[model samples]
Target: MTNVLIGVDLGGTSTKLAFIDENGHFLNKWEIETDKRDSGKYILLNIVNSISEKVKELKIEREQLIGIGIGVPGPVNFETGLVYQCVNLGWGETQVKEILEKETGIPVVVDNDANVAAIGEMWKGAGKGTKNMICVTLGTGIGGGVIMDGNIVHGVKGAGGEIGHIVSVMNDGFTCNCGKKGCLETVASASGISRLAIEAVRKTKRDSKLKEWYEKRNQLTAKDVFDALHEGDQLAEEIVENVTKYLGVALANIGSLLNPEKIVIGGGVSAAGNALLAPLNHYFNQYTFSTVRISTMLVLATLGNDAGVIGGAYLAKTYGDHIRKIKHNSYIKELT
Candidate 1:
C-alpha cells in the first residue's frame, strides 16, 4: 500500500484539505467555509468528516496515511500541536493535534500558517535550495516567517515571526495589535497604505479622482490607493512612496538580523509590483547592513494560496516518517 499524507490549511474564513502521496504528488483536494460563529470546535468535526469521506472514496486505508498536518492562522506550539489565540478566527488555546487524532485516528501535527508557507517556499517555491529565507505577507497587517538552515525559528513562545510587531519608532507614532507603538506593520501593511492615503489627502486637499472615489466617508482600502496611483493622483503617490520606504527599511532590518538569502513578499499589497518594489529597493539599499545588502534578494512569492497546504504536506511526510521509523524499530526490538 502506498503511504499518503493529508494537510489542512485552516484560515480565518476558509479551510482547505489536500491529500498528497509520499513523493508530494497531489491525489485530491477540497475547501469549505470556516464556521466561526461558534467555537472552532465545530469546524474540527467538519474537517474530520471531510477527510474520512475522501479517504474512503479514494480507497485509501488507515495504515496508508502516514500522518496529518494542519496550518492555522495563529501562533502554534509545534512541540505540543496547540493553536494559541487566533484573533481573526475567534479562538483561543485549542488542542489541534489531540482533537484531530481523536476524530481521524491518525497522528497529527500543527504549525502557524505563515510559518508553514515559508517552509513551502523554501521547499519548492521562490526559496528553493537556499537554507535561509524570509517570507512576508503584506496584507491588512504584515505577516512573516523566518527560516534558518531549513528549520523554522519558532522561538521560545512561538512568536518568532511576529515581524509586524517589531518596533519601527520609539516615540508615539501608531498603536499595534500587539500593544506596542509604531510597529513595522503600522507603516508597511495594506491598512497602513490606506491610512496614509487618507491622511495625505486631508493634508494636501488635492482635487484628484481619489477624493471623488471616497466621497461619502473616509472609507478607503489599499486597492483604492493603488487605483488612485494608477490615475496619477499626487496624494496617492505620496502615500505609496512612504509605505514603500518604510517597508523597505523594515525588510532591511530583518535581513540584517537573520541574514537570509532571499525575502519572498506576498499578500494583497504586493500586487502593486514594480510601483512598490522600486521605491522599496531604493530605501532598502540605504538602510541594510553591508553583508545583507549584498546577499539578499527581494522577490515576490510564487506559491500563492498553495503554500500552506504544500508546507503542511511536507511536514506530515518528514515528521511522520520519523515517527513510523521509531515505531518499527521499537517493534523489532520487542520481537527480538
Candidate 2:
C-alpha cells in the first residue's frame, strides 16, 4: 500500500486539508469552515472527524497512513507544538501537537503557518531546488518566513522571520497591530498600499484615475491603484513607487543579512505580477549590497492556495522518516 500523509493548513476562517503520498503528489485537497465558537474548542475535533472520514473514503489503512503535519496561524514552538497565540482563532498557548496526536493516534508535527508556506515554495514552487530562501506574503497584512541551510529559522521564541514588523517610518508613521509605529507593514502591505493611495488622492492637486475613482466611491483598493497605473495614472505610479521603496529597501537589508538564494513573494498583492515585480526589482537593486544584489532573486509564488498544504505534507514526510529510523534502530537493538 502506498503511504499517505495528511497535510493541514489552519486559518482563521477556514482550514485547508489534503492527502498526499510520500512523494508530494496531492491525492485530494479540501477545506472546512473554521468554527470559532467557544474559543475554537471544536476545531481539533472537526479536523479529526474529517481525517477519519477521508481515510475511510479513500480506503487508507492505519499502517499506510504515515503522519500529519499541521501549520497554524500563530507563533508556534515546532518542538513542542505549543501555539503562543492566534488572535484570529482565539487561541493562546494551545497544545496543538499533543491534542491532535492524541485524538488521531498518529505522529504529528506543527509549525508556524508562514514557515510552512515557505517550505512549500522551496519544495515544489518558486524556490524549488533551493535551500536558502525567504517567503513574504503581501496580503491584508505582511507575513514572512526565513529558511537557511534547508531549515526554517524559528527563533528562540518562535517569532523569527517577522519581516513586516520592521520599523521603516521613524517619524509620524502609521501604527501597526503589533503596537508599533511605522512598521514596514504599515506602508507595504495591501492595506498599506490603499492607505497611501487614499493619502495621494487627498493631497495631490493633479488629476488622475485614482482621484476620479475616489470622487465616485470615496474609496480605492490596492488593485485600483495598480489598474490605474497601467492606464498611465501618475498618482498611481507614485503610490507604487513609495510602496516599493519601503518593501525593496527592507528586502535589501534582509538580503545583505542572509543572502538567500531566492525571496518568494506571495499573497493577494502579488497578483499585480509584472507591474509589481518591475518596480520592486528596480528599488531592490538600488539599495541592496553589491554581492547580494547579484545573487538574490525576487520571484512570484506559483502554488497559490496549495502552498501551505504541500508544505504540511513535506513536514509529514520528514517526520515520518525520522520516526521510521527510530523504530528500525529499536528493532535492530532487540535483535541483538
What TM-score fits each model? Answer: 0.93, 0.98
CA displacement after TM-score superposition, residue 314 of candidate 2 (Å) = 0.6
Pick the lDDT winner. 2
User: Candidate 2, 101: how far from true, in Å?
Assistant: 0.2
Candidate 1 C-alpha lDDT tens digits along 95-175: 888888888888898999888888877877888889899999887888889998888899999999887887766687688
Model 1 ranges with Cα > 4 A deviation: 216-218, 331-336
lDDT of each: 0.84, 0.92
Cα lDDT of candidate 2 equals 0.92
RMSD of each: 1.9, 1.1
Off by over 4 Å in 2: none
Model 1 worst lDDT run, 10 consecutive residues: 197-206
Best by TM-score: 2
